[model samples]
Target chain A: MENKVLMKGNEAIAEAAIRAGCRHYFGYPITPQTELAAYMAKRMPKINGTFLQAESEIAAINMVYGVAGTGKRVMTSSSSPGISLKQEGISYIAGSDLPCLIVNVQRGGPGLGGIQPSQSDYFQATKGGGHGDYHLIVLAPSSVQEMADLTALGFDLADKYRMPAMLLADGTIGQMMEPVVLAEEKEISKVNKPWAVTGTEMKREHNIINSLYLAPDELEQKNFERYEKYKVVEENEARYESFMMEDAEYCVVAFGIAARVSKNAVVAARKQGIKVGLIRPITLWPFPKKAIADAASKVKGFLSVELSTGQMIEDIKLAENCKVPVELCCRVGGMIMSPDEVLGSIKKLMGGAK
Target chain B: MTTEILIAGFGGQGILFAGKFLANKGLLEGRNLSWLPSYGPEMRGGTANCSVVLSDDPIGSPIVTNPDVLIVMNLPSLDKYENAVKTGGTIFVDSTLIKRKVNRTDVNVCYIPATALAQQNDMPTLANMIMIGKVIGECQVVKMDGMEDAVNKIVSARHAALKEINLKALKIGNDYKE
Candidate 1:
């Protein structure tokens, strides 16, 4: 029987990783996301898994790098500032073509901004925060159920593409509680990684996994190869959900917690005689441009709702190729956008009647 | 049907727990639900609140701007959330803690006096359940059986001894007159 429980988003994500055969978890404590590490610390040992609390975020991510090198399912999570610290390591993981899971339970930020929900890391997660020509398969989950499901998906996609995948969530989603049915416990050998650096005694030669190359052309060729993999991911892995969009004249594009809130606003707007709908991007790195372009052809305009000022608006406009004006509705620095505010924006777009 | 509830009070008043109870009951009934708590440094010494949504259809926004039912256990919570209840909605106030009379006549106001009742019963921390009882009795937002199931799931084994008392407190509030 499947396990169903009422869980916080953070706890569910941790348990999902465990169920997905992720035995090694290394992380440092941070607000709004501390429960995740705490759950791992308590459960991993009981499951005969390894759970380590590193001295710093930098060390934890590097620990993930070490474990991922062994071809074991491994992951680390942190909030905004801590993620900033892990960027260098994340880039190295991407460059080395290693597979692993990274979770960013985002909080309001520029620097030490606040321990509240925010999506300010869109650019960082999608455009590559770590300084490199690479992308993380960014999955934005809107609910606790998605938190669990997407964590498993992140691992699968990471292994499939040999790249890092991120579960990009916000503080609200992390801290929120909802019912989630955890996936069945998966066997450890879901992927047979051939390039893992196990002891060389049984093999013909020792496998070496690294991101460094002595020759510039060698590094450039490696970059091109990684990009080729990324192109395949972009083509096949872009995921999104469209709601009430079949007859929509205007669409609200959002993700994670913002998407959850915008859904309410869309329902309310529809009841008030406005033909509004929602387009929720599940994969932020691939950006779901095709979905946006499709909606642009049918909708009168678009509204980009986010917990940040306007980070995702750029992606939305680019996806639509500036075919229609994409309006911005947002709340930043720990404040969340309310349904009334979003409905107000839709009403204004419909000439301020409803 | 959709019900949005906001429960607010001082940090130790189990305000978040009450919201959790409702959210769990909703989930147990196979309804769509969400419970969003306000997290920040204010959690240590300031007021705490949580928003709960129970809907027959898929819930869109978990953030409740105007709640169908507002439960405030302190004067500050009452002052902060009084205007956020929808017109003709219900507002449950802990009258023992909130001395100020509610000014709005547009909504249905039930002064539960949950704190005094819990103190009288020698269960000072059970006020939230009393308020929950009153909410369930007045609104019938969830089935009593669902609440019972939720209580069993939410109360850990370490606190198993307190379950009966909590249930009794809920009964007291449910049987509350006026």
Candidate 2:
């Protein structure tokens, strides 16, 4: 067994990014995710990296945009409200087709809701937070281990696809500490970036990186090309975890902390002779639609458990094409549903079926 | 077996630190464990708590809504979580700070003068460790054999000298009578 070190989820993401050859980190401090920035501030200088605390979240994301244009791995992290401030820059980055990592260690919010963990930012993240038609590859990590693993994966996927990737995590996973075996640091074989804005020095045509396409025909052409890339991502990048779905009669859809809670409920419900299971989506954007669609033909009902009012339920409904009955079990305003509460929902599904 | 432990007290009373030490000890024993602190806009004297889970199987939820072992340093914590413990679970209290007794009859309750013991032992800031010591001593959720190593891992090198005193406080609480 490899040596496992216990770490908070926020710290794990920072360390993994460093190991993934991300040397430029720019962010403003926010609650629940301040530790990631603090870790970068401490480690970046020692390793000859750039760690700048920008004046605002807007400035921080623009800095990410600037570094990304140069083709060096770069990232910025913030909680929900701060993320809201960075949406314009995010849209700009996506519009320019630049690759970078953006982390939203989400907190409860409509307007500075609370500093506690929440998954209410689901629509803003998956449906495009910044406006204009674009999707940032979104990865949801349920554990401290995935928090590290997905940071590395997010950077790779973003670079491979030439777009921004978002690690959409909530405050609980960001604050929780669990044992994680980090990948051994290896030499990073970076992808070739012929499109990078490295100065030509009169050798060739000057490379230009810009998002402005004032001509309607040109802008429409760009959008069509980006959607083609998104189509490839949707087919190849969708990821999820299926627990006890082999013989399940009911299905529970959740992600991140809510999934962890639902897993416990599934186990307990099984012991009580309820054949329920869980489908935890690892990538929120390229959602595991096929998994839910397959389960729809078999399961009696679907329960969407969330820390938000009811966000992911819509996706589950669309995935199954409403073939199975879908219901919502949720809490909001910084409240998390307990395992027993989820168990009750599972039992209710069973009772309704009978 | 899985043990869900909830330790609650004020922000600066080492509530989260004690949870981290127990979690590190569980890791040393090769048990799956998670430590989730209750983080918010909390100041030094504000309410603070953390949930620690150690299990032989893979852990599911990091949150411990119904703790098998509850440790409270202040009255507010006890008031908030006293009834949330499992039917046969144990509740450890710091008698020096919380003057009230456990109101529930179904659960086992042990009241130790942890703050008093820490102050008397000249480790004024270690009441949380003393409470944890009593928890492990009575419940035996984790053995005491690997505790020294756990402390070494949790306390950073800059605070190396404080490690010995922390172990001493644990020993005092572990061996305390009544």
TM-score winner among the candidates? 2
Residue-level lDDT of model 2, residues A1-354, one tens digit each, is 679999999999999999999999999999889999999999999999999999999999999999999999999999999999999999999999999999999999899889999999999999999979999999999999999999999999999999999999999999999999998775665799989998988898987889999999999999999999999999999999999999999999999999999999999999999899999999999989999999999999999999898998999999999787898899988899999999998888777763
lDDT of candidate 2 over B1-178, digit per residue (tens) = 9999999999999999999999999989989999999997666999999999999999999999999999999999999999899999999999999998999999999999999999998999999999888889999989989889999999999999999999998898899878
Tens digits of per-residue lDDT, candidate 1, A202-315, equal 656879989889899999999999889889998999999989999999999999988988888898888888888999999998989999999989888899999888999999
Segments in model 2 whose C-alpha atoms lie over 4 Å from true places: none
TM-score for predicted model 2 compared with the true structure: 0.99
> Residue B37 lDDT in model 2?
97
Pairs of residues at least 3 apart in sequence or in different chains that clash in candidate 1: none
Question: Which candidate achieves the best lDDT against the true structure?
Answer: 2
**lDDT (Cα, tens digit) per residue for candidate 1, span B1-178:** 9999999989888988888888878877888888988877656458999999898987777888899999998888888889989999999999999988889999999998899999999999999999999999999888876556788877888989977888898899999997
Q: State fnat for each of the candidate structures.
A: 0.76, 0.90
Q: At residue B105, what lDDT does model 1 achieve?
A: 92
Lowest-scoring 10 consecutive residues by lDDT in candidate 2 chain B? Answer: B35-44
Worst 10 residues of 2 chain A by lDDT: A183-192
